[model samples]
Target: MWILISFWVIALAAVIATIKYRKPLLLTVPFFAMLGFLVVQIAMVPMPFWETVRFVFSLR
Candidate 1:
């Protein structure tokens, strides 16, 4: 199962760090983009998990 609890924790930490350090907002944008990409890749909700489905049906 795709898990996001840890991601949320890390994101929260990043927010805290940004507040403390005053980093540029652009920095967080990339971080969130990457996170979204990984979440989609792991969850396989948009696609199958590398299970190679055949397009054509064959006679048994």
Candidate 2:
């Protein structure tokens, strides 16, 4: 999805910037990348509890 692509683009840009700037913050790139993944997952999928409740209620 577009959201995932944009998140990766921004993350890549941040990594490039960190490299060019030679800042210590570059060390956190992995964490930021993981956080981006988490954001995408949260955006794309329903939470397990919500899905379970939806299915349970729909069965009536």
Give the best candidate by lDDT.
2
RMSD (Cα, Å) for all candidates, in order, is: 8.7, 7.4
Q: Candidate 1, which ten residues in sequence have the lowest lDDT sum? A: 51-60
lDDT of 2 at 48: 75
TM-score for each of the candidates: 0.41, 0.42
Error of model 1, residue 27, in angstroms: 4.9
Tens digits of per-residue lDDT for model 2, 1-60: 886687677778777888899886875776677777765655566667567556656995
Candidate 2 — which residues are off by over 4 angstroms?
26-60
Error of 2 at 52 (Å): 15
Clashing pairs in 2: none
lDDT of 2 at 35: 78
lDDT of 1 by residue, 1-60 (tens): 234666566677777777888985734764776668765655664445443222112324
